[model samples]
Target: MSIITLSPAILDAQADGRGIVALESTIITHGMPWPQNLEMARQVEATVREHGAEPATIAVLDGTLHVGLTDAQLEKLAQAKHVAKLSRADLAVCMAERRTGATTVAATMIAANLASIRIFATGGIGGVHRGAESSFDISADLHELAQTPVTVVAAGAKAILDLPKTLEVLETLGVPVIAYGQDQLPAFWSREAGLRAPLRMDTPEQIARAHRMRAALGLPGGQLIANPIPAEAEIPRDVLAPVIEQANADAARHGISGKALTPYLLQRIFELTQGRSLDANIALVLNNARLAAQIACRMTLLT
Candidate 1:
């Protein structure tokens, strides 16, 4: 049996020359619980299709790297217990062990590139964690973007990370941080990070052209398209700053570090914001998926 399995929809889309958008599975397996994850996954796939692309939600199920999940596979994975979170480091290890795994941004990009899928959408990319100078807890997503030739569309790096440090590291990695239709990059749940984006493109066509140009120039890595959340759906940075600070403080107080740090902070923020954070997350993810699909369509047109 082949290690990679494409759903009939993706295979059909490929044959028909339709655009395809790669989606990360961590958003389903690790981002939420129960039926909500299933609903969100369905809605994201539908959004991709509605915008003229097929959605390939990446995961490793029973050691097979599934590029596009069937509804039954999606439901099973959503409810699976002890699913490993696969990044650049452990993705192959999990597969070798024949365990189920959810793909993070890095792992998803690797899978998408292997499958020749050019675009990926997700809520936010992980980055340099806070106090990373001490903990050295930077995320592999940054380095993956430095080498993988797959365009990733995300609202931004999670606001809980050190945004400035993350930006600096991306710069060091020679990644183009392009904000879509805006001057400043987004801050995940918030619309503004107070940091000017390195580049800006206002339309899907321009973004697609840029992607093509990168290949023409033999660029090593992918573009980071920072698609900001719609204004009405965004939580302002001013409103979110204190909540993030409080969350970080709580994590530090509890001596939370490493992988446990992020989820802890996010949960605290969700509680402090009275569940508004998750709502905003859903909105931003949907928004990113829509933009990613548009870009994917333009990508095929350019091809």
Candidate 2:
């Protein structure tokens, strides 16, 4: 396979030994609204910098895979309408078509591996959706985690999905799920998903060591660091339960399925929660970015 071209900004960071954290672009194009999406993208990068690491926001624009983006690029992407949400299946097709694309978790992981970036931070990863048994609607993220060699720090799987089933899929795929500071897994907007994590690592160094160990053992896939949302920022499972149920019901009633399902449910949840869900979502992402940077810094020492 041919190499994917990266922006000069990302090239410099990778060469300079600065702890580089990979960020997905879908959050800018599909995860949030215009100005706020642009703002959040910048804030997440700034947060990584403040924590002693450089941020590489990955996306595909006009046939080019950008490992890090400039402010102009970020703004352009945030406002651009109908940009393809690129993932493992269509990443190369979009690049071949010379079209603009926002990298989802799987696409971002592929780009991160190409750029030799070891750590990635994102809000939440997609997984086995509810009723996936018949629909067969599993997210590409689970398979990507099983093959990509980058450490992904997220607030667990998105709360809208079946958390236990997602965990089972990860376990079946041989991916490690390490819950940070807590034994229970996080449920996106909520701090606890009411399920025990497969592994626990309390510090960045420990996480970094695990990454190193995997590489030493010649493991092919990455580890998931389930960093919980802050207590103050969390929506609490009890409070989120009813909201999620309502959102799921709304999706079913409206016949929303596949890719449309997540965004639809999220928007409904935002409305249902009076926008509290969006607030909590932003808080959790920033929290994950900070921890990813710390782990990135530790990995840098090894390199």
Candidate 3:
């Protein structure tokens, strides 16, 4: 059997040379609960379509790597339990074991590149977790950005992480971290992370050109486009800081670490914020989808 299974729509888009934006499925399986996850997935894909690009939501199901999922697949994955959250280190292992798995930013990029998709959209990218000096627990997403050739549009690193350290590591890895239409890097749920971005680009066309130019210059890795959440949907940094601190404290109290930490923090924040954080997440994801679609379209034009 072929390692990859492309959805009919994705195959058609590829045949027609249409713009395609890759989406990660971990947002559906691991980021949220049932119905809301399904709804967000649909809305995000719709946003990509509305912006003149196809959405390829990548995942691995029963040993098959799917470049794009159909509606039925999306529904199944949304409600599926025991889904492995596959990243760079374990994506292939999950496939070999014939397990259903959702792709993280790192795994998604690898699959996206295999499908020749040039852009991806997500709520946020993982980075250096807090207390990493001793834990040394950095996300594979950062290393993937240093090697994969897909431009990723995200709200920025999840706010629960050490933002400054994340930025420092990206710099060391030679990854271009460009804030979109702003000078400040966006926190996952907030418009301002209180850190100046390393670079800034105000237009999708400019971002596309930079992506191509990197390839021309023989640069390895993709660019990180830090797109801010729509202001109307953002939880102001001042308002969210305390809530995040509380959640972090709760996690530390429970000794929650590693893979369990992110989800626990997000869920706690969602509860503490009265569901506002999830709303912000959905808004940011849709916002990123729109920007990624525009960038993908611009890339097609440049091609």
Candidate 4:
């Protein structure tokens, strides 16, 4: 009756006290198309290994929470149809139903924390959606960071969200939003979001130390490492602003809301960008994976 299934590599990493970076599964199941998603998953895991850390891609497969999937398992998950996208609210229910599910940031943090894995890498964390006064729309990813002890590395909040409001909410929740090597926060595909991050750390050592200090102080929340997307791969904010606006408009026109809205907006943006947005997404994810691995390695050294 083991509820959690750790992959052989993950178990070995835990036993050897090696650095292990937890990766979320939503990117494979909800973020991209099939073959490309599979390819991206392989590349992200490879990048983590290349940077001297083991990658533990978290997902739920047949009622089992897997902390690092084998190649065949990854392939099957990638090709599987109609997998539930699990967040904190639905992860346990999906498991109880014996349904396969992909982990969102919240669920991934929960799983990583449960497995004692301290670092996670993702494309971007979700945040306050536009017009929150009326719709009260927000993402659970922010709140999860406020309580989960896993350090999350990302290109920052997805550009589709209200960046300023997201930052405000993170501050309210007492989460440390550290911009990696920069003053301005990154906006997913773009390098700058036109707002200042609350904190900045130039090296992985600094980030690792901060994470350690937080635990030493008995803090409840985790650290957010806002790693910017590579400059060469960025789509530029001015160019993407209108694309995001148009995508949001389209989604609203179609009466999309809640969980269904993100994919719909992303799809419209992808169509508007002529596939450039997806390429930037892939590049940023690889970049974040690299940074996350470096931080994880540093964490092990600190220990």
Question: What lDDT is reached at residue 126 by model 4?
Answer: 95
lDDT assessment of candidate 1: 0.93
**Per-residue lDDT for 1-303 in model 3, tens only?**
888999999999999989999999999998988799999999999999999999999999998999999999999999999999999999989989898999999999999999999899999999999899999989999999999999999999999999999999999999999999999999999999999999999999999999999999999999999999999999999999999899999999999998888999999999999999998999999999999999999998996
Q: Candidate 2 on 121-156: residue-level lDDT in tens?
A: 999999999999999999999999999999999999
The reply for model 3, stretches above 4 Å from the true place, is none
Clashes counted in candidate 1 amount to: 0
- Our model 1 lands, by Cα RMSD against the true structure, at 0.9
lDDT of 3 at 46: 98
- Residue 249, candidate 4: how far off, in angstroms? 0.5
- As for candidate 1, its clashing pairs are none
For each of the candidates, give the backbone clash count.
Answer: 0, 0, 0, 0
Q: Can you tell me which runs of candidate 4 are displaced by over 4 Å?
A: none
Clashes of 4: 0
Q: Regarding lDDT, does 2 or 3 come out ahead?
A: 3
TM-score on alpha carbons, each prediction: 0.98, 0.98, 0.99, 0.99
Error of 2 at 132 (Å): 0.9
Candidate models: Cα lDDT each: 0.93, 0.92, 0.95, 0.95
- TM-score ranking, high to low: 4, 3, 1, 2
Output the lDDT of residue 145, model 2. 98
With candidate 2 superimposed using the best TM-score fit, by how many Å does residue 26's alpha carbon deviate from the native? Answer: 0.5
Q: Write the per-residue lDDT of candidate 4 for residues 212-276, one digit (tens) a residue.
A: 99999999989999999999999999999999999999888999999998988888899999999
- TM-score, cand. 2: 0.98
